[model samples]
Target chain A: MNRFKSFVIKEFYHIFRDRRSLIVLFGIPIAQVLLFGFVITNDIRNAKIAVLDYSKDDISREITNKIVSSQYFSLAETLNNDKDIEGIFKKGRVKMVLVFENNFAHDLENTGKANIQIIADATDPNLANLLVSYLSAIIMNYTLDMNRLAVVPMQINMESRMFYNPELKSVYMFVPGVMAMILMLISAFMTSITITREKESGTMEILLVSPLRPSQIIIGKVVPYVLLSFSSAVMIILLGIFVFGMPVEGNFILLLAESLLFIILALSLGILISTIANSQQTAMLMSMVALMLPTILLSGFVFPIENMPFILQLLAHIMPPKYFIIIVKNIMLKGTGFSYVWKETLVLIFMTFFFIMLSIKKFKVRLE
Target chain B: MENQVVITSKNMIKKFGDFVANDHLNFEVYKGEIFGFLGANGAGKTTAMKILCGLLTPTSGEIFVGGFNVYTETEKIKRSIGYMSQKFSLYEDLTVFENIRFYSGIYGLSDADIKMKSNNLMDKLGLSAQRNSLISSLPLGWKQKLAFSIAIIHDPQIVFLDEPTGGVDPITRRQFWDLIYDAAHNGITVFVTTHYMDEAEYCDRISIMVDGRIEALDTPFNLMKTYNSENMDGVFLKLARA
Candidate 1:
């Protein structure tokens, strides 16, 4: 036990002593969280818009007011001529351009036939689609109100409420994803590198040649990484709570227990990786390519798994992060307990057991 | 055989898939003797040594280390033995004291015992001043010497040195043998493998392996006389050519 203590202490020394690893372990997560939260977001706010108001009428004015007041689009300029639309779009600050035809009020008053032009930048197709829908919704609402002046009519209403994240704070969603990513990196990636480092330096052979069982050697090497990953999870959670306004609504102990489980899962994965890799460089490359990228991409940390292609969706089902992210989201946002997260818990448990068993088998094969 | 024999192997064969590494090799080392297992590169000396050290499992064999069966009692065999590989097997990031503590820990030593033995070992090695220094900061000779000291930190019944003096200077090699002599004098069996023929001559008994089998096994003087050669090297060259 004393030897195990010193061995774990040596692992901690290796982790804390290296500047590049220290930065990668802690720096990237926090930076990604903050960047995803405040800088990069799906919700459009204050989008630049230009208007060509040829109608000079009450309907056009009301529609413009609604668009501006919705806070989704800001009116950047009132274009004088149709030719100026291209120049304004080329400037590229303006994402949308609205052109109201001449005699629109007269045409609507007589035959209810008025034309409106909505031009959008097709460079960013997703943003363009969103902008088109937003402008159309505003104009439709205004037209319906104007039609009410003539007669009262039955209408369809669509009422929607976003659960948990009403304001759709992207940071709230990213906090748990960041926690998973950082924990996996610090636990699995770092542990594999450190273990392979011992192997490369020939210290592992010495330990093996000693009285230590292979299981004991692996455990002693991985225990410190699990603890470090746990602390890293805690740190990310604390940063989310204090720095960002991320709320943890579920039983705090359940959340911590789940985090600990995921950390173990990642550490076991690291051990499996180290067993397969002969060098520290190979371990690092495997961790990045096999674990980190998949954890970020296929785990629904950044991309939605449901919306992925068929094969990728099938692949994402096996990624441990996908389940972990669901558990975290349920706990943090929906305030659910084990009853809600039991399925994800089972998947994590199975993955952890699978990885650990695979690693033990691989280690035994190496001893042969 | 109460401490009479340190290691015994009969028809030991280590096969990886279809390739046999230690092919039906028979060997034994007596207690309190320096038995050198000699071989050229890839001659399976390391493979045979690994089996004796409980690091590798033989496919079909009867192997015993310190009178304990290797297949079922590897742990017991491991506790009774120590090993230093071709690469000096010390954690370079750790201090000399830390490395000693680490090895002793795997052997399940108490803190007080580790403290006591480390001091005595360092004093005997003339490395008392370098105890607190990292192994990386030490010279090649010191690292090699320190590796040997830490290998036997638990004071095992036998120590396996696998080319322990691979890259050290001739002076260091002589000093390393002094340490080996010290271990042998303490009634510890020294089972070593080396490519250096002169080092083989210093052993009480030496086995020369070529092509995965022991081509010759006898005392250095007896092997030279049996082969009608002047030195151990001449005998090795003759066996290697054969």
Candidate 2:
């Protein structure tokens, strides 16, 4: 026990002495979280749009009012001629342009048909698609209300109800992702680099020559990192709850327990990486390429795994953070307990065992 | 073979696939003697030392250290012996006192025993004043000495020194030999490997290896007379050339 204490103390000294490691462990998580939450979001608001009404009629005017009042778009200009559309779009100030046919009210009253053209800048396809959807929904709702007044009805309506996040707040989604990423960085990447540093410096040979068993040595190296990652996890959760208004609807203990489990899985990954890397720089590079890329790309932290190709979706299922994100989102948004999360919990357990078994095999081979 | 042998290897072979490192060589070191093992850059002195230290297992044949077989009783042999490599493996971020305490703790020394012995060891090596200083700040010679001292801090029966004096001033080399002599005087058998012929003369008995086999083993004077050489260097060159 005294030996283990001394070993842990040495690990702490290594961590505190390296300033670069300090920043990578603590600075990266909060920066990424704030950037993803505030800077990169899908739910755009207050986009400027231009309108051209060739018809001087009540139907066209009513449709214009409905578009402006929906709050999804704003009228930046009212173009008098068709030539204005090119210049407005080229200036980049207007994201969308609307045109109404010459006899809109006459056509609607006599033939029950009116034509409107909504043209969006297709350079950013995602934004264009969202603008098209929001506008169509608003127009359809207005037409349905008009049909109710006219006695004959020919209108279609579509209502979107976002389930987990009704307000579509980006913070609700990014907070859990940021927490998983930061915990993996601190636990796996940092711990692996530290252990490989010792190996490169020859201090690991000294420790191995001593009477301490290999298991004791490994545990001693990893325990301090587990504690550090746990604290970082808590800090992110608190920031998400208090500062960003992300809900914490589930039991705090369950959230913490899942976080701890994932932290251990990441720590074992660090150990596994140390066995493969001969130098600290090599270990850091490996962690970034192997752990960070997979965690970010394949773990559904940014991109949706369901939309990926089949092979990539299979690869995503093996990523540890995928399961971790599911658990975090479930507890925070769904207020779920173990009964609801047992499948994900079991998957995490299997991944942890896989990493531990591979690391132990590598360690034994190194000992030989 | 002598009955009181501390190290005994009989046709011991170590091979990595087809490359034979220690090839069916036989040698012995008796108790309470400074035995020197010398060879050129790739003559397999390190391979033999690693096998004896329980860090590596030989490919074939029998090897024993402290009367325990390398194949079956490696952990027991590791417990009964100590090893120090030329790398001077000490944690640079740790204080001198902390390094010593850490080694002692892992070696299963009690806290009171560690404190007492660490103080006495540091005082004897004239490093008592810098006990709290980080190992990185100390000179290379001091680090080497501290590493040698810590290697045998457990008071093992035999200590293996694999080129312990690789790079240092002549003064530090002489001081390191003095520590080895001190260990010999206390009945701790010293099995050391070195390239310096002057250091070879200080050993009670010396062995020169050539192509993974010992070509000469005796007192320096006897080997010189047998080879008709003026110094140990001439003898080593002649044997290496043959």
Candidate 3:
């Protein structure tokens, strides 16, 4: 036990004595949280757009005022001629162009319908789609208000409610994702690099030749990283709560317990990686390519898994972070309890056990 | 001289998918003796040493280190022996004192014992002033010596050095031999593998391995007389050429 304690202390010395990794350890979580929170968001604010008002009527003017006042858009240029709309869009100063057809008010008054053409830059399809939807909603609201007194024969009222995130704040989605990503990065990447560093530096040979069992050595090497990753998880959670106004609606203790389970899963994956990698560079490359990319792309962190193709959806199911993100989202946002996340927790536990067993078998084979 | 053997191996064979690394090797190392294991690159010297150090399991062998079976009692063998690899095994980021303390502590040394031993070790190596310095900042020779010292910090019955002086200057290598001599004199068996031929002359009994087989095993004087060579290097050249 004393030997294990000393071994753990040695591992800590390796971590704390290296100033650069220390910065990466503490610096990355805060930077990622703040970056994903304030920057790198889907919430469109003040999108630049040009208005081509050909109608020159109070209704067109009022619609333009509505778009501008909604805070989702800011008018960059107002065009008179139809040719100017193309020029404004080509200059890239605006992301969208709202064209009000000539005699818009006259048509609405006589036929109860008017044409409003929305020309958006589809270079970014997602942002373009969002902008068009926002513009259409504002115009639809105007028409509804204008014809409020005229009773329709049959009308179906569709009231859509976004549970947990009523305003659809992007930070609510990102906080859980950032937590998954940061924990995966720190736990898997850092642990793999550290263990492979021993192999590269030949210290692993010395450790193996000592009285300590290989399992003891691995556990000792991993304990420090587990603690570090747990702290990083805490830092991300605290940042999410205080800085991004994210709420921990579920049991806080359960959330932390699940986070620790994910950390152990990542750590075991790291050990498995280090077992296959002979050098630190190889270990780092493997972790980044195998763990980080999948965690970011396929874990439902940045992309919705349901929207992906069948094959990619199948691939996303294999990623540990996908289920972890689900658990975190449910616990933090919906305030769900153990029953809601037990299946995910079990999968994480199984994965951790599988990786640990695989790594131990690989490590023993390597020694032989 | 009391020729009490501390290490014994009979027909030791290590195979990696039909490529035999230690092919039916047999040798014995006596207590308080410096046994030199000489080999060319890929000559299986490291393979044999690793098995003895409990780092590898031989496919078939009857091996003993410090009277403990290498198969069933590997942990005991590990505790009874110390090892230093060719790559200096000290953590380059750690201070000299810390490295010593860490190794000693892992070997189950008490806190007060570690303090006293590390202090004495630093003073003995004339590195008291640089005790707090990182291992990377030290010269290669100092690092090699310090690694050797840490390898034996627990005072094991046998210490294995895998080319301990690979990159050191000749003078430093000579000084390192003095430390080995001191350890041997204190009843610790030294099993060292090296490519340096002159180092073979310092061993009481040397075994030269060529392609997983012990091609020659004897004292330097007897080996010289048997090979009809003037120096250990000439003997090695003749055997290698043959």
Candidate 4:
């Protein structure tokens, strides 16, 4: 134990002595959380749109008023003719245009049907789709209100409720993902680089020949990183709660415990990487290519895994962070218990065991 | 000295697949003597040293280090020996005082012992003024000397130096040999490997390895007479040419 203590202190000295790495360690978590929370969001607020009202009627005017009154959109320009629709979108001032056909109210009154054309600039298809949906929702609500007063016999009323995230806040989605990515980056990438650094400097040989066991050496090297990654995880959670109003709906202790499990998993992966790489540069490259890219792209951090190709969906299932993100989201957003997340937690545990075993095998081979 | 064999190996062989790294090696190192193992690049000097240090297992041979079997008692062997590599292994980020303290602590030395011993070592090395300085700030010669001191900080029974004076100047190398003599005089066995034939002359006994085999082992004077050469380098050249 005394030897392990000294070894850990020496490892800490290496970390604290390097100022650039120190900055990157603490800076990345905060920056990622804040950037993902405030800047990159899917929630549309005050989206710019145009209205082309050919029907000079009270109903058309009321519908236009309703669309702009909601926080989802703001009227940017009024198009006088059909020719102005393309011009407004070409200027990039508006993402969508709502054109009501002439005699719209007359058609609704007599034939009970009216045509409203939604012309959207599909340059950014996601934003255009969202704007059209918001407009449709408002129009649907207006028609339902009209039907309620008119005593319509046949009406289909659809009620929807979004369970976990009621307001559809993007921060609720990004906070857990950012936590997974930051923890993986710090634990796997940093630890692999540190271990490979010792190998490069020839210190690892000295340590290996020392009285300390191989397990002790590995544990001592990674304990400091475990503490650091855990602290970063807590900081991200606190930022989500205070800044973005995201709730930790489940047991806080369970969430932290699961974060620790994932951190250990990532550290074991780092050990495996270090065993394969002979230099710090190789370890760094391997970690970025194998761990970071997969965590960012295939783990559903930015894009939905279900929307990927069939082969990519199969590939995503093998990523450890995919399960970790799900576990975190379940605990933080849905307030789910261990029962709800047992499979994901089990997968993480199995992966940790597998990586540790592989690392030990490779380390022994290296010694030989 | 007495016939106290500190290291004994009989027909020790280490093979990487079909290539024999240390083929049929046989030697015995007595206690309190400076024994040198000399070889050219890829002559299997490092492979033999690693086996002696308990870092690798011999393919099929009997080897003992510090009275512990190299195959079954590797952990015990590790605790009883000190090893320094050719690459000057020391934590450059750590201060001179901290490096000593760290190595001593891992060797199971107490805090009080480490404090006193480190002070004594720094004072002896004339590094007391730079005790707080990082190892990287010191000159190459000073760093090599400090690394040697730290390797033996535990007072192990045997110290293995694998080209400990590789990159330093001749003056520092001479001074390093002086340090080696001092340690040997204190009754610690020194096992060193080097390619510098001149340095081999300073050893009590030298073994020259060629093609994964020890071609010659004798005192410098005996080797000179047998090879009909004036110096250790000339003897090495003749053996390598043969």
Best by TM-score: 4
Interface RMSD after interface superposition, each candidate: 1.7, 1.7, 0.8, 0.8
**What digit string (tens of lDDT, one per residue) describes model 1 on residues A256-294?**
999999999999999999999999999999999999999
Total backbone collisions, model 3: 0
Model 1 residue A289 CA deviation (Å) reads: 2.1
True contacts kept of each: 0.72, 0.51, 0.87, 0.87
Colliding residue pairs in candidate 4: none
Mark the regions of model 3 whose C-alpha exceeds 4 Å error after superposition: A106-111
Candidate 3 CAPRI assessment class: high
Report the error of model 1 at residue B213, Å. Answer: 2.0
lDDT on C-alpha atoms for all candidate structures: 0.87, 0.87, 0.91, 0.93
True contacts kept of 1: 0.72
TM-score of chain A of 3: 0.96
Name the regions of candidate 2 deviating beyond 4 angstroms.
A53-74, A100-113, A144-157, B1-4
- TM-scores computed on chain B for all candidates: 0.96, 0.96, 0.98, 0.98
Complex DockQ per candidate: 0.64, 0.54, 0.83, 0.87
| Chain B, candidate 1: TM-score | 0.96
TM-score list, all predictions: 0.93, 0.91, 0.96, 0.98
Q: Weakest 10 consecutive residues, lDDT, candidate 3 chain A?
A: A151-160
lDDT, candidate 1, B116-167, per-residue tens: 9999989987889988898889999988888888888788899998898888
Worst 10 residues of 1 chain A by lDDT: A151-160
Candidate 3's displacement at residue A105, Å, is 3.9
Candidate 2 residues A202-321, lDDT tens each? 777766666677788889989988888898899899888887888877889999999999999999999999999999889999999998889889889889999999999999998899
